[model samples]
Target: MTKAHHIIIVGGGAAGLELATKLGNKLGKKKLAEITLIDSSRTHIWKPLLHEVAAGTLDSSEDQLEYLAQAQWNNFRYRLGRVIGLDRESKELLLEPTLNDEGEEIIPERRFSYDTLVFAVGSLSNDFGIPGVKDHCLFLDSTEQAERFQKNLLNRMLKAHSQSKPIEQGQLHVAIVGAGATGVELAAQLHHVTRLVSAYGLDSIDPAEDIKLHVIEAGPHILPALPQRLSDAAMRELHRLGVTVHLNQRVVEINAAGIVAASGVIIPAAIKVWAAGIKAPEFLKDIAGLETNRINQLVVKRNLQSTRDESIFAIGDCAACPMDDQGNNVPPRAQAAHQQAMTLSRTLVRRLKGEPPLDYTYRDFGSLVAMGHYTTVGNLMGGLAGSMMVSGYIARFVYLTLYKMHQAALYGWPRAILISLLHFLRKGIDPQVKLH
Candidate 1:
């Protein structure tokens, strides 16, 4: 009897989870292939929502998807383990043993053979060798880190409010090290949430007087990745909200008190957030002798298959696919990852049927940045055969549609609509920002 072909997918982020859902529904139930998804965490949360999670605007308990539950619904196997090594010749993936919080072995190290493999481990914040950053700053790369910051923020506020004497100096100061989408949105959301938190019985603290937010960026202006007009609009809105904007300031160190810039200026703060850059996990550098870029992203061909091995594929932030059109590589963003996931899904389906897979070409759909419910700005492309700028409520509507698009891709139309309605109903009943 012929062995059943197996397809293994490592990582369960936006791309991996969507791909697994699609492929499993297509092949797993039909008994054509065994679909397996391995991830370190048992639940999945959209990475873009991490900033809001950190700021307490979104409750992770309701938003996160349980991997095992999803696997059961989507007809796929979920394995809880980290991929430690790969044996190309044997076509087996070596998984490291998993340990629980109490140091008990939850899953032992084992090998899972696959006819095809897909890697979508995603990326994390890049400190760029800045001194004291790893020790003093918080990065919203995962749900755990976001929860830690939120808890710390709540504790700091309570301690300051309960103090007998006057509010101490630098009590609610927050320094954000980047002015990109994450940093800008986080700063704006924090401003709103801080006010809400104070109004919700933390009477000793004043949002306008006690809280301080500073956004430091090395570029000439904030939101450098977006169009100048949109960036200007966001900057103006942030300034109107009383957020100090420090442009062209490169952080050299993240001291306990604050951040030190290259210009010899020190900014003091009670909490610091590092949101500047991102790089793939360190382990990918030597994985299977693959050629990786400076940030340790695997180099892949136009077909989205790794150059070192055709049977292995990568997508999302972990793969570096060059673009000859602009003489630059694809930018690491949620849209890029979602697009790549769709492309790979189609290609792999064709390959399963013994047909040639097509080359993956990235379409440049413009970018959008949201500053909470206050406002939104973006550039729209492929509109009426041209591109145009958009802002305000209309842009906010479009911004929300992007998330819906992601949901539609994974859950289909009916389920996506139901889930969205449920989310809205829950939001109306619960507090907008998490207080605890």
Candidate 2:
């Protein structure tokens, strides 16, 4: 029997998992190709939901998807390791040693060869060499980090509630850098959940008086990437939520005490969060001679293959695939990732069948920003009707549909429907916010 072509997908993120599932069903099930997915994480959680996890609004245990189980159901193999280096010439990858909590080696350094390699490693929070940001500020880039923030936030809340002393200047303050979607959404979520946590018998810390939330943005306005009208709407909503939105305030430095803005204002914060810009992993810049942008994102052609090699492809936040010659590239949105995954699934299938790969054209389905449980605001891209801004319940429904769409992609319609029902049932059975 002829050996099946090996297709190794690294990352297991939204793009990687979706691609693996589609291709696994299309090719692996038919014994056409051997599909394998690798990642440093044992489970996968949708990145957009990280804010919910950090705010204690969503429990990670309830939402995280285990890689081994998903692979078994989807007809792919799973490998737990981080790809440290790439050897394009030999079609091989080097994985770093995995260690346990005691610093003992759990998995030794290893190498894996592939016939076709797909990179979906995703991006991380870029500190831009900022002093003190790394040690002092919390990041929401991964589940572990989000959980750490969640636990710390809970502890601080408990301490403040139990104390007979008045809250210190920075004790109940939260300064969030970057007013992007993640930062903005998190600011709103923290406001809501903290108030809930306080209302649920933690009366010492007054949610309305003692607690403070600051959204520090360097840009002229929050949601700089979105339309000015939408940004204005979001700001209005945020203001009503009692959040202090600091506009045009560039963070010069961050410490345990607070953040110092370029304007020379010190915003004291007990818990600091950095949700600023993102860049691909540090090692990807010149990995195996692959072209990379200043942010270290792998540069790829329109077909989503690396500029230097066709056998390798990249998608999601890690790949810099141009949408046009004018230096425009696909936006790092979940929608774009989903579309790229669908396109690449077809691309890989066609390649195995000796057909030309199709070019990926990102369809802008607009964007949505949810303001916790209150409402959601965004513009929906209607094919011919141009773009129209949506808010309130309609927009909130659409915002939720995005995640439902993702669930449908991964688990199909039946399981997705059941999951939705379970979520509804959970509303009555579980606490509105995770207390522990």
> What Cα-based lDDT does every candidate model obtain?
0.88, 0.92
List pairs with backbone clashes in candidate 1.
Answer: none
Backbone N/Cα/C clashes per model: 0, 0
How many angstroms is residue 119 displaced in model 1 relative to the true structure, after the best TM-score fit?
0.7
Residue 69 CA displacement from its true place in model 1, Å: 1.7
For all predicted structures, in order, the TM-scores are 0.97, 0.98
Global Cα lDDT for candidate 1: 0.88
Q: Write the per-residue lDDT of candidate 2 for residues 75-175, one digit (tens) a residue.
A: 99999999999888888999999998899999999999899999999999999888989999999999999999999999999998888888887798999
Q: Which stretches of candidate 2 lie over 4 Å from their true place?
A: none
Query: RMSD of candidate 1 to the true fold?
Result: 1.3
lDDT of 1 by residue, 1-436 (tens): 8876788999999889988988888888887788999998989998998988998988888778899988898888999998888888889899989999999998889999999899999999999999999999999999999998898888888998899988856778999999999999999989988888888899989878889999999999998877888798899999999999899999999988999999998898989999998999887886878788899898888888998887888889998987676668887888888888888878888878887667877787777888877888888888576667888988888888887888787778898899989998998898878888
How many pairs of residues collide in model 1? Answer: 0
Q: What is the C-alpha RMSD of each candidate to the true structure, in Å?
A: 1.3, 1.0
Clash pairs, model 2 backbone: none
